[model samples]
Target: MGGRGTRAVAAVSAAAAVLTGALAGCGPMDDIGLGQSGAADGGVGKGAALGVSPLKNPDGTGPGLAPITTSGDRAEARKLIDKVRTKGRGPKTGYSRDKFGYAWADSVDGVPWGRNGCDTRNDMLKRDGRKIEYREGSNCVVISMTIYDPYTGKTLDWTKQHAAKVQIDHLVPLSYSWQMGSSRWSESKRKQIANDPLNLLPVDGSTNASKGDAGPATWLPPQRSIRCSYAVRFAQVSLKYDLPVTTADKDAMLEQCT
Candidate 1:
């Protein structure tokens, strides 16, 4: 009887040891550092090693969000047309021809080329030219520049050799705007529009001349795939700046955007 009792006691002890070992293998039931399972005390987890927090939830519900709507609206465009009527008439030639043979007027809104040390050509060169190397000690002038032509999808090296190749295109062409509502704008406002980044795009000079102040109804970028995006951006800029769009222009934008 004594022998049998001792064996039973030994068996029970062995069972307890096995259960303790299993529990120890699981480490602890408490939260580990950086929520890593079986991690050493105070150790950061793999997420921290990757420069991210393991506790962060990525569901995109942070702040300043509004519901997105897919519906198209032309209200802003109409409002722009109305506002432009208040500004008074724009230039007569509508930036078609300058005395200098450039497509743009020699002066916009009485701000003459090289007047007050401001030249439209130089201004445009500074505005559109990329990788610009400035003339020494001249804050307002660029001696040489480079640009990527969105219209042609080509990078143009615009040194003095190809200075004329890079043209500043009006997003709302001057002629088109004149017909729509610019015919009534103050000279200052007209000048503002002429220099406005929203209205300017760098393009091949010849191509821009070919476009010749025409709206979407008549001309588009040479690249057909960009037409929709171009029309939409043009419409948005016009709407933002209170430029007018003719019925035909509106129809063309709608066709492209839709």
Candidate 2:
């Protein structure tokens, strides 16, 4: 039995050598690292040590990250909206031009929070801007940062001077919130909505101004291609925050989504 086993091992080794030699001359099997392991065949190392090839499209680009969606609970959003819609407006809130400078607000609700405290602009600057550069080391607050504009697919090197070039857009405008349900909310809750990342997007400054407290029924992205994702985000934010949408706004959203 031992002699038969030895003979079988010898036959298998001989067959493997023959097969390896045959395959080495052609095809993808040309560089099998059998005996000359490591630095052989131009430093390819072991066969099993190769890294995975990155998946790419025919055009050689990798897939993009999925679009942003609402983070707050939808039920909680609805409750908040219901609560705020019934309430009356809080104390007259005023925003300083020095803090926002050149950024326009259409209604009292547009600048819901006072001065620089809990400003949507600052919140968005923190959330959307990357590699933030501050005016002074003493001021931990960011004066500027790199922003990627999803609307136009452009990277903007935003600075404090050009900060007005990007604006924090409310997916559901504050005035819409006021009419729908925010009128009923406490000052604290209103401030939360103002600073919510889920509702804020850094978009073209002029475009955001033009949007001006309008709902989906009245406004859509000037860049037509982004409208779908914009509508989805709008619906998600409103539904999450319990903000009521008019029939027209709902219809427009459906059209954009479809």
Candidate 3:
């Protein structure tokens, strides 16, 4: 991730007077159930006490990517990890952002947030962030919000003005997907994988960027506790897209759960 933030602040001076949420995961409205690896909007990974357990969110619909600390949850995470097939990665000869569709394209059909009017990026922001501050006259354009970031185990005060602070990460990167045989998929199928919520996470930008195109073998979240849950999420996306991971990546993923 670039050192610079990605969002363009519309009115910085005005926002100085606006209120931002101080504690993200403690409230009832922002979190409930197993949200994203357990990064549920306002709640997931609020830490060991506040986050959801991955065992409860098999579908990857929940928000945050919390750690699987319980023995049972870890075992379940391993079960999910075992489901992904192992194989060699293909070459990255003809990969590019355009290969999947414009970044966060809402028109991509057959994905959860597709055709939802809100683009996938904002949809994910709304999906995983809490105490959202939308721009005046626009609920879809989030100006700022508090996020419980599972990767670094820190609550982030983020604004669209500082987009890099909070990025919508592709849990299974697009280029990695290409190398894993997605290159052969039809454009629509590629689009589905690219925009799917199951494949996305809202995480600290630099941490997310540090994982550039790396699979589980080469990179995992810095937070050790969340590793098992991260692997489960990766496996979930792989299965959903009918994609495969490299043999080493699959092995490493399982090790996290073990």
> How many pairs of residues collide in model 3?
14
Best by lDDT: 3
Error of 1 at 238 (Å): 2.2
Query: Please, what are the lDDT tens digits per residue for candidate 3 over residues 1-258?
Result: 343432324345335434233244344443354343344333234332224555665554566666788788788788888888878888999999899999999998877657978888988877677766788998688888888788888988898777888888999999999999999999999998888887888888999889999999999988898888888889988988788998899899989988
Predicted structure 1, TM vs. truth: 0.54
What are the per-model C-alpha RMSD values against the true structure? 18.5, 16.0, 13.2
How big is the positional error of residue 99 in model 3, measured in Å on the Cα after superposition?
A: 0.7
Give candidate 1's error at residue 201 in angstroms: 1.3
lDDT (Cα, 0-100) at 59 in candidate 2? 13
Q: Kindly report which residue stretches of model 2 are placed more than 4 angstroms away from their true locations once superposed.
A: 1-120
**Higher lDDT: candidate 1 or 2?**
1
Model 3 misplacement above 4 A: 1-51
What is the per-residue lDDT of model 2 for residues 96-185, given as tens digits with 9 covering 90 to 100?
222222332222243323244434455445434555665665333567666656555666777777767887776667766766666666
- TM for every model, in the order presented, reads 0.54, 0.53, 0.81
Order candidates by TM-score, high to low.
Answer: 3, 1, 2
Model 1 lDDT-worst window of ten: 57-66
